[model samples]
Target: MDRRRVIIDTDTAGDDTQALVLAALSDRIEVEGLTIVAGNVEFDHEVENAKYTLGLAGKADEVPVHEGIRSPLQKEYETAEYVHGEGGLGGELFPDTGIESADAHAVDYIVETARENPGEVTLVCIGPLTNVAMACKREPDLDELLDEVWVMGGNVNCLGNVTPAAEYNFWVDPDAANVVLRELSTTIVDWGVTVRDSTFGPDTLGRIEDAAEDSEFAAFYDTITQQVRAFNREEMGEDATTQPDSLVVACLIEPDLIEESGEYHVDVDEREGMTRGYTLVDETGVLDEPANARVVESIDAEGFRRLFLDAVIHGDPERSLA
Candidate 1:
């Protein structure tokens, strides 16, 4: 099987860290590079956090991390420190390994990488869409090179996490999100209803940790569990946490785990005050044009968890957590 080449644009939140781990450990996905944006934390912190995360995943040398935009094109960046904590990894600290940084700008990196592997690169964005949008603006021909863009933003049929109508990723940078949703030919894993319906709670986390105990990926899984527990205690006031990015990662590694509906014309609300960054879908079938994106509506939770565990374990039944 030909592995899918991918470039991840993220903010290194706890959830984003989990997604990185999944991508690094998966054989089906070849991570071309990582671009850090300003969301979940500041741009510098996000870049450092991406390095730390890839180091933790034991792929720091294989992936080049680049720092992208410091703020949105229009609105000021807002972070969910309450959920991701001060350090953006649930306050967990790791020693800096001083990895070499990317020499080129993130936009340039995205364009160059896509140009090198035309129609084979998949842009998996799990945070604010600033970098991808800016890259598209800088290189208008990127649309022809990209095979697909899997974005983890927008709320199609569910309530928003930031505002009553907007999801956190889009709400942080509505202008950037709007640019990507409108200009790029991509697929959006809608947060509105898809995420809420496909949650990985305590049972799944415990299974993952248990499975990790016998694999070389044990340490990675353990670290992720600790962060998840902290996030749960701080945000949900419980010992179990539900990870959103984990779901996105699962979708990437195993697209069959997610059941999708028909394609739809999705738009982001950029108006000020109310409904900013909300993803409004034309569900009535009144639009004359064809749908630009294949929107994911639901996922098979059990299958997704199994794939996640398999990716972590990688058939090493004797993997030791220690």
Candidate 2:
């Protein structure tokens, strides 16, 4: 089987780390690079988190990381520090990988990569859409050039996370979300599906803890998830670890994980209001517009948990739990 060439545009926070590790260790994916954008945390911290996470997957020296935009396309910068913590890693301290980001800007790298390998590269965007929108603007045919674009954002005809009507990623940069939704052949792994399928409680955490006894990757994962798990339990009234980014990556790696999906005309609300960044998913075709996105409505919950655990426990050869 030919490995899918992938470029992950991420904010590199807690769950973003899980996504990166999964991608880097996957046999079916050849990660082309990681492009860092501003989101969950500070720009520099996010870049560092990417390098560190790649190191955990034994790809620190191999996969190049490129720094992207520092803020949203047309909004003031916002962060979910309350959810992700100040350092974006649950305040856990790990040894630095001493890896540095590639000198190229993320927008330039994105455009150049797509231009160099048309219809082969898949972009898994797990953050704000600023970098992707700019790349589209820079290369007008980028959407056509890419093999696929999978995004982990939007509420998609459901309630949101950051606000009553918007998910955090889309809320941070609605303009960019609007642009990419309109331009790209995108697939959304939205917030509702994540809350329904990807949230894991103590049983799953116990499994990770068991794996952590032998696997450093699992240990690192357990350590970093401490804060988010607490936040989810205390604040969200959910006793589970939410890893939406990892769920989206799993869907891309194993398509069968998606039990239900549909093509929809999706758009983001850029206007300032309670509905700002709200994802209007045209499920009933009321607007009579062409569908722009394949929205993932549901996924196999047990399959996702297994896939994530398999990666965390035995993905890296040197750090395998067994």
Candidate 3:
């Protein structure tokens, strides 16, 4: 099988770091580049954090990290420092490496790369949809050129993380999210409910820690473990953090892991109200145009976790977390 070429748009939050590690380790998914957007942290901070996380995963030299939009299209950039901590990973620190720049702006790179390889590049976005939205505006035909876009956002029939009707990523940039959900051919991962159902409880964290003792991903695993614990205790008052973005990576590597997906017309509410940034899914199937996305409602949690663990621990010797 041919390797899947992908460009990841992220903010390098704790969970985003896990997804990045998994992608770097996967032999089946070739990460063409990384675009740092402002969501989990400030724009500059996220860029630096992305670089640091890549360095920690031993992929700094291989991946080109780009600075994306600093704020949303029509709203101020919101951050979740309370949940992700100051540095977006519970204050986890990595060695200082020289600041490497992206070869081009994220929007330009997305358009150019996708156009160059029509139907061969997949854009995996795990943060606010700012950069991808900009790309759509710049190229307008990007949706037709790419293979597919996998997004870890929105809530179809479940409670949201930021507000009762909004997930954090969508809440931060509803306008941008709206653009991608409506204009782009997307595969939506309803993390709101799926993540809660596929929780990485204490047992999973313990298993990872125990495995790390003998694996090459020890330091990276240890850092992720600490952040997971902190997110659990500080945010959920629980014992583990739900590996949401890691699940997104799993969807890319093992699409069959999620057996059920429904066609839906998703709309994001951008108006200021109790329902701001809420993703409204038309489950009644009353739309006219071709459904732009397949919203994931369920997942095989064990299969996904195993895939993630294997990817992080054994997939790539050069980028091992040991």
List RMSD in Å for every model shown.
3.6, 2.4, 3.0
lDDT of 1 by residue, 112-200 (tens): 88888899899999999989999989888888889989888888877887878988888888888878877788877767534555566
lDDT of 1 at 213: 64
Best by TM-score: 2
Please provide, for model 3 over 219-278, each residue's C-alpha lDDT reduced to its tens digit, 9 standing for 90 to 100: 566664575577668767888767777788777877777877888778889998889889
Worst 10 residues of 1 by lDDT: 313-322
**Ranking by lDDT, best first?**
2, 3, 1
Query: What stretches of model 1 exceed 4 Å from their correct place?
Result: 208-239, 287-290, 313-322
Clashes of each: 2, 0, 5
TM-score of each: 0.89, 0.96, 0.92
lDDT pick, better of 1 and 3: 3
Clashing pairs in 3: 216-321, 216-322, 217-321, 217-322, 218-322
User: Can you give the lDDT of residue 319 in candidate 2?
Assistant: 35
lDDT (Cα, tens digit) per residue for candidate 2, span 1-322: 6888999999989899999988888877899999999899888888888988888788998899999999887788578777777778887655677887799999999999999999999999999999999999999999889999999999976788889899999999999998898789999999999989998888999899899989988998888988888888897786678889999888877888899999989988899888889999999999999999999998999888888888888774223221
Order of candidates by TM-score, top first? 2, 3, 1
Q: Which is superior by TM-score, 2 or 3?
A: 2
- Whole-model lDDT, candidate 1? 0.76
